[model samples]
Target: MLVWERPEPRNRPVPAPLSRDRIVRAAIRLADADGLDAVSLRKVATALDVRPMRLYGYIDSKEELLDLMVDAAYAEILPVGDDWREVLRSLAESVRHTAHEHEWLADLLGGRPQLGPHALASGERVMAALGELGVDAVMPVTAAVNAYVIGAVRREIAERRAERTTGMDEKRWQASLGPYLRRTIATGRFPALATVVRDAAHLDADDTFRIGLDFLLDGIGARVSK
Candidate 1:
């Protein structure tokens, strides 16, 4: 059973009155500072000034700890409303920003379904905004936007890590590719590719996310009107 579905211990004789919230918060702090692998039951306990075994009263294992972390982070990702387009747009942008803020978020998001309260709340906000579409359509619409958010976040963060590793941002990376691109495009074997190489303005990640999000939202808007 999931840790949230179980009762928290009420009368543990720990030094501090530890709640699940406190434990989860401490764990997230360790993760944010040193990355996810740096977080452990011992590390979280040390942060809380308690024994590692004390955490067992609130959470059972590392997997459960990750679940709590993901759900809690979802609190920052809840959406705002305007039209459905605006609502989902806000959601997508918020999630992207949240994942960037907590870079480890992109890793845990793919592992399990986020059924915790805050995760459910984030979904509810988007789906309710699209409620005009009726029950059947609302779910798929929300799912499509969420799919884009998840995929975009992962790719954005992956590139971010790569940049960090090599100390090269997009422009420098593209500059490195320039020689090979020039040699390949000279043959006139790939006219479409050559034009993009020559003419396309290299957009940064933020602009790419915005433009891609528009594609999904515009398609959904067409369906909503029909």
Candidate 2:
């Protein structure tokens, strides 16, 4: 199912009738149906009812197709406010939304960023927004924010997939762990764990994401001010 180890997209000397957009779209559909791992030139060709080698006329490799797919996903993300902080937050949330919609996007995002036109434009927009904050080292600041957002989205997606596969919500999982947790608490062995469970309200994904975003933005602000 892994595309990386699969055969290369058959190369062709002459231009095939298939357009790059059509191939990328087909690959995206394949990913949607069976995940990014299931996407391959061979499979995409089958989906398009063309020979695997024919796809090479448009796409060089699965890696390029994946990069295109990532950019295509990026193309769907909307740009936000002109303010630096607001822009960063909006962009991150937009990416998170896209990843949530296409689970395969999360996997591809963790790989190299596609410097394709749409992806580069997104980066440029983020950097331009940071200009509002008088950030001289725009590239580094943007990279840091990008890294933070990517890491956050990746964790979010993986955890969501885990929950789906297990068919258990957080409440159910916590309830199942209740006995063991209570037993540990009863022994008074871990005061911190006991105190947290007693005092802390459970945070859902959105709440946790907001809290984490605020914390990260606080740090970024401090850096910007310095």
Candidate 3:
């Protein structure tokens, strides 16, 4: 004899209504508070007071949520003045500021291809600015600017994270390593680096970023003028 029985339906909690925008915002908040690794679907669902399954309707995976978050961040960056140099400078500064505010952004930026609407709009604005300047190779120029900004911001974020983890600022960290550095410099085999280690002025991260950006832009200007 065989017995057939229908299993009882399990009770599941009803999830609150959630939109994509709300989901993305919640994820951003999580990331802002506790770095990118903290932004998981389950965490975001908990923040939104919804079941994790409900988030699946709005966001497919962590990567998709990150893409949406990146787009949302880009949307915060409004267009500046029309002058090409000013526009580019303003864009770089804005991105740097945004990266500082959202430290996780430095991790994702330039790490993947961003084709979201807001990301595309940002690229369009930069391209238009270069076009206004009669840049013959707009893509290369835009890429160069993006490369500089992304690299600079990534370095800034890395140093910040390192300091936070080590409980020491750059100066203190250097001082801690002073004995080893001094011994290595005394070997007289690396004169140029020794000179820099001994004589280089200590610029804070922000100043270093701006100075490097200005130097890059100066080279671009020289090329354009020629």
Q: What is the TM-score of each candidate against the true structure?
A: 0.92, 0.86, 0.87
User: Which lDDT tens digits does candidate 1 get at residues 1-226?
Assistant: 7776888888767468799999999988988887898889999999989888989878889989999999999999979977788898999999889999999998887566789999989888887888877778887887788788889999988998899899999889889998898898998999999999789997878898899999998898888778
What shift in Å separates residue 148 of candidate 3 from its native position after superposition? 1.1
Weakest lDDT window of 10 consecutive positions for candidate 2: 1-10
Off by over 4 Å in 1: 11-14
How far off is residue 18 in model 3, in Å? Answer: 1.2
For residues 1-226, what per-residue lDDT tens digits would candidate 2 score against the true structure? 3332345444446444566778889989888877988898999998888899877756678887888788889897766886888888888789888888888997877576467778778887887888866666677766776687778888888877778899877788888998998998989989998999899987888888888888888888997787
Better by lDDT, candidate 2 or 1:
1
lDDT of each: 0.87, 0.80, 0.81
Clashing pairs in 2: none
In angstroms, how far off is 212's CA in candidate 1? Answer: 1.1
How far in Å is the alpha carbon of 2 misplaced in model 1? 3.0
Over 42-81, each residue of candidate 3 has an lDDT whose tens digit, in order, gives 9998999988987765555777788889988998766576
Best by TM-score: 1
